[model samples]
Target: MKIIVDAMGGDKAPEEVVKGALNASNNPEIEIILVGDEKKIRPYLKDSDKNIEIVNAQEVITYDEQPVNAIRKKKDSSIVKGLKMLKDKKAQAMVSAGSTGALMAGGLLILGRLEGIDRPAIATLCPTAKGPILMLDIGANSEVKPKNLVQFAVMGSIYSKEILNKYNPTVGLLNIGTEEEKGNSVVKTAYSELKQISSVNFKGNIEARNIFDGDFDVVVCDGFTGNIFLKTVEGFGMYIFHQLKNEIKKSPRYLAGAALLKPAIEKIRSSMDYSEYGGAMFLGIDGVLVKCHGSSDSKAIENGINVAYNSVISSINEKLREGLKSVTEKGE
Candidate 1:
């Protein structure tokens, strides 16, 4: 499988991105195409083998520029060029740790949306007490109709089942309350619609507090709510670790106890790490695209590439198309 990496997209461009690509290229069956300024990316590939290829892209779309405008004007940019390669079938997938706005815009403009999909959603794997739960529409579409939520649920289910290896994944709608009568008009309508869809194993509404229990395999929400939920979880995880460290330092007794429980603490820290899950998948896009964090390190980028590889090999897009078709046929 061939996967393209946006070499100049992230904060640690060219260096960390190149290192991640090289690491992922250790798999002989996978070819890594690094697209960026050749001069900057070449140095990291001194000991690289045949699986790695470099494509020169002179421009880079920055977070400051307008997303659509940057994509249109920066024809030679790594984001645009790498997306174009995917559109042209030169590669199976593309991974970028760049501006999220540019990646989403370029994805729609270049690769287009799946035939039956309206408004592609970003599916992110969130670590929970039980395991990883897939959440969708996180920072993708801030405003969405009821139908959009239904689509997110469908897409999230397919991804959970195929990529995450979940069997008959149960989906939940993120809401203020678990009751069917709860939430705003969009969610209420979505609840009614989601229940009617036979293709999805739609569970009732799930509150934010209950999300960590991992009772639901997939949770669908509008980007406005999902983004806040994702950020709050990340912030809280950091806060917990920070407070623990400060508390441990305050007392010698606590310090000794923390040292004894260091292994357990390290395991908890690993579970909370965003890099462990790689990156979010831009589901409903016509082609495979994985969007990594803007500040992603070599490890995060490497895992993101593995995500792209898995998506391509699993025929995720094809399964999604079929899933959507089934929903449409059922008049959902």
Candidate 2:
């Protein structure tokens, strides 16, 4: 399988991206296509294996640039070229640590949405006590209708079973309260529709407080709420860890104790670290797209490449199409 990597997207850009892609190239079955300025990408690739391929892309889309405008104007940007490779079937999947808006824009405009899909939703895997739970529309479409929510649940379920290896994953609507009538009209309507779909294992509602408890496998929410929820969780996790380290360092007594507890602390940090999981999967799109964090390191890029490779081999899009069609037929 051939996977395209955007070597010019994230904060670290070509350096980390090249290192990660080269590391991932160790897999004999997978080939890496690094898309960026050839001059910068080639130097770092001296130690890379023969599995790596470089594609030259001169322009780059920055975070501050308007997403739609950047995509339209920057035809030779790494993001656009990598996405085009996937669209043209030259590559099976695409991974990027660039601007989320530009990636989403390119996915919709270049690759297009799946035939039955109304809109593509961003599905991010969050580490939880039970395991990683899949949440959708993390930053895709902020405003959506009842139908969109129902579709998100459908796509989320397929993703959990196929990619996460969860069988019959329970789906829940993220809401203010667990009651059926608690949310706005859109969510209330989505709840009723979700319950009717036999393919979806719809569990009425999931409150923000209980999400970490591992009660639900798939959580569905509007992009606006889900983005805020995801960011808050990430920020709070970082804050708590930082504060703990600072407090432990203040006293020599606590510092010595922390050394003894180092193993346990490392385990907790690993569980909460987003880097381990690589990137978020953009579901409902025609091709496989993994959006890594803007500050992703080499390890994260390697993980992202693995996800893209596996998703392609697993025929994830086929399963998604079948799952969506099954739900639509039964619901109709």
The candidate that achieves the highest TM-score relative to the unseen native structure = 1
Error of 1 at 48 (Å): 4.2
Q: Please identify model 2 stretches exceeding 4 Å from their true place.
A: none
Clashing pairs in 1: none
Give the lDDT of residue 173 in candidate 2. Answer: 98
- How would you encode candidate 1's per-residue C-alpha lDDT over 146-223 as one tens digit per residue? 999999999999999999999999999999998999989999999999999988999999999999999999999999
Q: lDDT per residue, candidate 2, 94-151, as tens digits?
A: 9999999999999999999886789899988887889889999898989999999989
lDDT of 1 at 211: 90
